[model samples]
Target: MAATETVAERPDYDPVALAESLASAADKSAKVLGDFIARQAAAGKSMVTDEFGLTQAFLELAAKMLSNPYRLAETQMNLWWEYSALWQSSMLKLMGQSTTPVVEPAKSDKRFRHEDWEEHFLFDYVKQSYLIAARWLHNTVANVEGLDEHTRRKVDFFTRQYIDALAPSNFALTNPEVFRETIASGGQNLVKGLNNLLDDIERGNGQLKISMTDSKAFELGVNIATTPGHVVFQNDLMQLIQYEPATAKVAKRPLLIMPPWINKYYILDLREKNSLIKWCVAQGLTVFVISWVNPDERHAAKDFVDYMLEGPLAALDAIEKVTGEKDANVLGYCLGGTLLAAALGHLAAKKDKRIVSASFMTSLIDFTGAGELEVFIDEEQVSSLERKMSERGYLEGSHMANTFNMLRSNDLIWSFVINNYLMGRDPFPFDLLHWNQDSTRMPAKMHS
Candidate 1:
């Protein structure tokens, strides 16, 4: 009886219990939201005006925000303190501790300093001015009457737009493909306009080449030399291997190629017709490719430093050894390009002067302007991810793949979903798609 009583006295607060409660709440919320959306669809109503739609959108955004454990924890901690302080005083009074003074710590000493009074006063004045202006606008809108139907509609539209703009739901997860398509479409239009203007300018001087060159033209016209008898050198880097020509007779100078570790080097060497590598070779450029080793559990201990030293530097050494050239032009694509920039910076700091010209393709440096990835790279999100990766020793390749897929959900993920799942059509084979499918694993250190 004593043992049973002791067992029964165990604390009720448990992590599993909290998790279950959260899941149940989430399930209920999802069900409610689904039903609301279904009702709106049945009614053939747009999401713009209906109160339920607005409310649902806000809830959805909130849910998305909460999905990030780090943000969720921070928010929860803040709310906890706010509510705790509110109730703490009452509880203390009820427990006969009211006579004891509750000393609240100062958040900032500057708030009390006399010198900062003017600054605080100015801030208060600006805040109050904004509040007064907002109230005036609200009152004016509420009192408006006898307006024409067109004017009323315009007002309604503006009001809805303002509310929607302020709604948190508007910031929820959006399809990346849609965003990319929009941007690309705009870019293409701009390019077309620019080209037309350029063509007009060139027409006055001579004949203008208005046509775009196909991949075949690049292969045949370029004079780098990829004939049958040409010898290409190969070197092994653990499980991976790199290939480059033994001698570049046509090339004026040696060129070093840095491919992203996320994908294989074969993208630049797909086939004779569409091979960028072959094109460069035909253009008289001495070329070398960096082949990244596919990582496994055993390679989890490797980090960014190891990749910097071994990957590009090793390729550089091989290029110099084969071509007898001390310096070479370096080109990097995407993540590889970013790594190359970092490596270059590191080398520059150390006063190393082996690199000549450097070129980057679709590579990100400053993340401040990163369009969609910001949703995933906030401090809270990264911290939560770090915790998970800490347990696994390394982040899995699938995780990185999923992130990229999410960035272009409409095109990379959902467009396929519609075609393959909804329409019941097989995926069409395209060279770009083929390359995308041939993704390589990122080493633990490089990934981190």
Candidate 2:
């Protein structure tokens, strides 16, 4: 106590560094504002569309809830009971007494994986409180009757999205890990996080395009898509890649792969250990893959019929020309599978047996169980999207990427929000995420 400590030994040291970081953050924030203003100005003359139609849907939801006051009362009563129990449990924990959580996160939920979420009393309380409220909200909306199926699904989907956005782990003040990082870094984490947020907004032209991976760490043909292949055929729709044979002798009929045009083909050939294209070639089969064009306004009029005619059908013709085989085995994935089914039907009608065998991977022939995606399929939303697409000639790849991210909002969207923005950490380089973030535009007719 008698000895005076130096400024270096003080816990609150380095005012200059902190001030510099804050100054840099302020500069970046100002730049962000300028960019946003420029974006709005550039879009001044563009027509605006209600892309989601969330307003009318929510109005109907509110109207239904008000019409059924007794149901609402019952739901509120149940929520109150849960909250009372949670309060009691939280008090017992505060007094160092054994207590059980009112609700636990799903086993697969990674947002609350930190030990502090369970070990720290306040964090535990926040987590359980949020879980209970979320459960009650989901159950109430899901049980809502009188609303049509599409409207009900839309309401339920968007409600979950709202709840996911409000999770404690997403906010630095509420997230224990982020909070600790903020304190340890003397709020520099926050300053850097601001810079990150501004960078993403600028990258998206004022929209928030979350960075999912270290994009610069990968390239198309260097580290990934490294399987030896050549563009044997190309047309307006796609480029057909023929991989070098791994064996002296190959299969009599080549294997033609039709990857989804909604994404690039490199997913199957991401790396050596996991490359499906390489694996197929090793099995003594000639592999042919369709790499769809990342279309632009020039391809606005290209339809599904054009895709079938020019995609798989054209590939089959080109394969015969190269390998001297009239028939070949075909495989399709996702949207490609849908196209394959249509092409098969078309060929069957023409009595064309060029396709000797067919395989489908995660294809959707029926829309009955379209799950959360059905939220975007209603007529109003579709029309709104079409209007937007008509002007641009194609739907932006990022728009579809964002839609898919919303399906797993906590995992794909909010988790990154916490790590990359709140915690001020760069996203780690990951192959699958790189692929996920490497989105391709969907042609207007094909997408619709």
* Index of the highest-TM-score prediction: 2
Per-residue lDDT of 1-448 in model 2, one digit per residue for the tens? 4356543444574779889878887887788878787777786643354678888988999898989999999999999999999999999999999998989999999989899999999999999999999999999988877999888988899999999998899898889999888877778788778888888988887778889999899998999999998999999999999999989999998999999988889889999999999999999999999999999999999999999999999999999999999999999999889999999999999999999999999899787888888888878878877887898899999989989999988889988998889999999999999999889998898778
User: How good is model 2 by TM-score?
Assistant: 0.94
Each candidate's number of clashing pairs is 12, 0
* TM-score, one value per model: 0.48, 0.94
In model 2, the runs with Cα more than 4 Å from the true position are 1-13, 45-49
| Candidate 1, residue 385: lDDT | 61
Q: Which residue window of length 10 is worst by lDDT in model 1? A: 167-176
What is residue 178's positional error in candidate 2, in angstroms?
0.9
How close is each model in CA RMSD to the real structure? 26.1, 2.6
Q: 287, model 2: CA deviation in Å?
A: 0.9
* lDDT over C-alpha atoms for residue 176 of model 1: 28
